[model samples]
Target: MLAGKRILLIIAAGIAAYKSLDLIRRLRERGVSVTPVLTRAAEEFVTPLSVSALAGEEAHRDLFDLTKEAEMGHIQLSRVADLVVVAPATADLMAKMAGGQADDLASTLLMATDTPVLIAPAMNVRMWEHPATQRNLATLQGDGVAVVGPNSGDMACGEHGPGRMAEPLEIVAAIEARLASGPLAGRRIVVTSGPTHEPIDPVRYIANRSSGAQGTAIARALVALGAEVVFVTGPAEVPPPEGVTLVKVQTARQMHDAVMAALPADAGVFAAAVADWRVAKEATSKMKKTAGGLPVLEFAENPDILKAVAGLEDSRPALVIGFAAETDDVIRHATEKRARKGCDWILANDVSAGTGIMGGTENAIVLISDAGAEEWPRMTKTEVASRLARRIAEALEAG
Candidate 1:
């Protein structure tokens, strides 16, 4: 599955560095080209010659090596690879990575690379349990770094807990799974995310707690499937995925225009909780509260973006998916919405404040479509995106 793929393996200074050698061999066996980068500390556990021998390529060491830099620039080296794998990533390396401290080749390449990075942390049980390490881990994860394992078991220090590097086979499996899960390859999918702000005044507006997590997750999942995704979002708290085409919009009208402009695509996923209504005439300035009389306000219906695209005669996407944010009778409402909007599918979610699904990491959704309404158990946004992408791919293939 890794055939013809270029994988840059960054080896950190740790006892687990020895296992990385086996990982190189396993990866090469799958026809993946390996370019190994060794940290100064990594030389303590394994030799450059051994790694080179297994990889069938010269081991990359010393960021300041004049000859190597002249031939292959560090920035170019980092950008050339499809993915970066950091095994035996020590606590020091993790801290450096999380903090953008590039004192060495590995850290420098890590900071320079635009590719997806998978870090397998290997450290002492105590070090891994340290608060600083935990904080660094959160930072890395929040920065969109993928973590494999620091599995709990007997460690090299003769201590047992969560500090072991994932086994070579396990790491290979994870990598392969990542490669295989990309089912939307070569397709262009446009997704609208977050809550639109309908201006109530200069300072006041109508908005919702849509963190944009699900939309960002959907974009990332699509990227994994090799899809070129245009993510139209509002002023979301969460960061958009790397390498995505991002369009920031504040109002429903702005989002609608962005989605329409990115048209003639394979699919469209309307995940944003766009405000249903906007002030009919927004005040040029903030409306002052009158002391004696009640202030009157008028609301106008926002454009139905999903219906607009689904009912398009010429540029309609092959698949149109809409999100139904309901507080009650979720399935019934979602089913009606799917038909009313002429969308192929509706992802229904309960967004009651108590449910915490609106701006939270976890979600419980019902997939309502012409086929049927399938209730999906609560899952992380990433997992939901993965399953949805797979289902979409299945539908496409079946047709």
Candidate 2:
């Protein structure tokens, strides 16, 4: 899967530069081409000669090397690669990236490159814990920058909690995941994510605790498998992945309309936890606090998106998947939901508080269909999405 793929490796200022050398060697062993770039501070730790010798390519260090610029300018250098990896992504470089600063070659290449980026951060535990660092991390993640890890263990410094760079093998796995393509190529799919907002007032709305992690991961996985994904999302905590058609919506009705408009797809994965009801009559103006007693509000059923799409005789997706978040009788409820909604499958999960499935990073899902209910053990939302995407690909290939 890694053969002939080009990786632009950016070595930032950190004590973990040694790890990056091993990273380059590992990439080369997997038949991947590595182009190394070293920041000025990176040179303090690892020599350019060593980096170039390991990579078997000249290490690019300056943003404005007049000779290289004349040959292949910075813009060309940035665009020529399939992916860019930032190793030993120190706090300062991360902050700079979050702020879109292009003061150095590494930062400028990151800003200039359209290729996907994966960062491996390494720093002091205290620096990693800083709110500023956390905010920076969030910003980068939201902008679709992939991160490997700062695995927890003893750091270069005396104190340790987190902030060690991930092992070379782990990083290689992440790279392989990013570059891998599958049978889903040339297929188009639609995925809905996040909890739909039901407006009670202009400023206030009723929403569930869905953080949209699973749906977003599903979309990312689909994209990785060479699928053209239409991602329809409501207010989601995580940002949509790069290289997809993103449609943002606010309410369940809006989400439904968006999904329907992106129709004639290979599949439709309705993972959104849409609200069942909305205010019967939304006030044209914000209702003010009055001396009168409490106002009586009415409720109206929101549009049933899953049923509408699945029941369509002419334009239904070949594979329709709905999500059932049940607290009790999970399989029974999901089975009923699949039948009622006319969807091909229903992925059921327990959203009961203790499960921590809802709005959390991990998911324990049950895949229910006409065949039977297959129980899947607890796994990360990303793993679940990847497995689901692969299943969809297999089903489509068979069909």
Q: Evaluated with lDDT, which candidate comes out highest?
A: 2
Candidate 2 lDDT, tens digit per residue, 1-399? Answer: 788999999998888999999999999998988999999999999999999999999999998899878875778778888889899899999999999999988899889888888888899989987989987976886576766667667877888666888778867866765565668865778899998999888887888778889999998888788776778888899986665656678899989977876676789999998999999988877888888978789999999999999999877889999999999999999998899999999999999879988888899999999799999999999999999999999999999
* Candidate 1 structure quality by residue, lDDT tens digits, 1-399: 689999999999888999999999899999999999998879988999999999988898889988778875688879888889999789999999999999889999999999888778889989987989987976885575766666667886899977888778767755654454356654667889988999988999988778899988997787777665667888888987654545668899988876875666778999998888999999889888788797688999999999999999887878899999899999998899998999999999998869988778899999998789999999999999999888777776676
Candidate 2 local lDDT, residue 266: 82
Clashes of each: 1, 0
Please list the C-alpha lDDT of all candidates, in the order they appear. 0.84, 0.86
Over 4 Å off, model 1: 1-181
